[model samples]
Target: MTTLHQEHTAHDHEHGPACGHTPVPHGDHVDYAHDGHLHRAHAGHYDECEQGGHVAHDGHGHAHGRDCGHDSVPHGDHVDYLHDGHRHAAHDGHWDDH
Candidate 1:
C-alpha cells in the first residue's frame, strides 16, 4: 500500500507516557493511540501512523472479524481490531500488531 504523508493538524496536545493516550511502541519511534487512530509526532505536528512492514503477532489465538466483540477500526484497506490497548490485523497466515 502506498501510505500517504498524513498529518494530524490542529492538534495541540502532546503525546507521551503522561498524556493519557496509549503509547504504542512502533518500529523506532512511538505512536499514541487516541480515539481509534494512531498518531506519531513529526516536525512540530503529528502524523497518522502507518507501519512500513508487518510485525508478526506471535502466538495469537484470537481471531478478529465480524462479531468478534472487539472494536473494528478501518485501516488502510483491511480492518484492524482494537485489542488490549493495541491494534491487530490478519496477515499472511497469522496476525500483525499495529
Candidate 2:
C-alpha cells in the first residue's frame, strides 16, 4: 500500500491606503459630502447649468458644469484626496473601514 502526505501554510499581509491623492486647500470654499466623496464650492466661482442653476467651482476663478470632476474620497469623519494613484488620508483623523 502507498500513502501520500500534504502540508499547508498561512500567510499574512498588510495594506495601506488605496489611492494616491493629497488634499490641497481649494481656497475659502464650502464642501458638500456625499456618497464617500466631497463636492466643493468656492466663492466668486460659479458653475451654471443648462437649467441656469449654479453647480460647483474649480478653486481657480473659473466655474464648472454639473460634472466638475473634483471628487475626493471620504475618510472617517475626514476628507481624503486621490492624486497620481496615491491616497492621502486626512491627518489626525481616524480611518473607518465600514
Candidate 3:
C-alpha cells in the first residue's frame, strides 16, 4: 500500500477556485495542481500529495506524448497524459495512472 504525504508546501496562500490552480479529485481527496506538483489540504496546512509508487495499466495500448490529443499535466518530475477521465504517466515499461 502507498502512504499519503503529509508534508506541507511553502505556499503562503490558500488553494481553491480563486487560487488559479485547477482542482482535481483524487480518490477521497481533492488535489490542486500548482507549481508543477499536487497539493492537498491537511491539518491547518497543506500536503505535497505524493503517491510514491507504480501502478501499471496492463491493457493500455495507446502511446501518449506530444500531439497525442490529450491534455498534458505537469507532475513532480515528469508529464502525465490525460486519457478518458484520468491522467497517465509513463513508467518503466508501461503507463501508470497519476
Candidate 4:
C-alpha cells in the first residue's frame, strides 16, 4: 500500500504604506482572500500627490490609468494589491480547494 500527504504552506508578508501613501481600510473596497490569507482591498486606488500626500480614489469616478505608484500584483487572470508588502488575491467564492 502507498500513502501520500499534502502540505500547505502560508506566506506572510508585511503591510505598510505604499508609494508614501497610507491605505485606509473602508467597507466599500473589495476583499482579497486566498490560501487562508486575507489581504488588502482590490478596488482601492491610491495616488501620490505633489504635496507628498496620498489621494484615495475609492474606485469611484476616478480613473486608474495614470501611474499612481500603487503596489499591484498580476495574479492569474486579474490584478491584485500589495498592502504594505503583502500581496492580496481576489476571492473566488469557492472553498473546495482549501
**Residue lDDT tens for model 3, 1-98:** 26476777567879887888767677777778888887888787888876667778779999998999987778878987767666788988799876
Candidate 4 residue-wise lDDT, 1-98, digit = tens: 11112222332433355423334333433223332323442223222111122233232322222264555544446544544333333443311100
Candidate 2 lDDT, 1-98, residue by residue in tens = 11112211121211123323333233242233333443332232322111122222223232222354544556446544433332333232232111
Which candidate leads in lDDT? 3
Clashing pairs in 1: none
User: What clash count does candidate 3 reach?
Assistant: 0
- Model 3 weakest 10-residue run by lDDT: 1-10
lDDT of the structure predicted as candidate 1: 0.78
User: How much lDDT does each candidate structure score?
Assistant: 0.78, 0.30, 0.79, 0.32
TM-scores, one per candidate: 0.58, 0.23, 0.77, 0.23
Best by TM-score: 3
User: Which ten contiguous residues of candidate 1 have the minimum total lDDT?
Assistant: 1-10
Model 1: per-residue Cα lDDT over 1-98, one tens digit each? 22346998888889988998767665567777676677889888999887666678899999988999987766666778877766789989898987
Judged by lDDT against the true structure, how good is candidate 2?
A: 0.30
Please list the residue runs of candidate 1 whose C-alpha ends up more than 4 Å from where it truly belongs after superposition.
Answer: 1-44
Could you tell which candidate, 1 or 3, scores higher by TM-score? 3
Worst ten in a row by lDDT for model 4? 45-54
Candidate 2 off by > 4 Å: 1-70, 92-98
Sort by TM-score, best first: what order?
3, 1, 4, 2
What lDDT would candidate 4 get against the real structure? 0.32
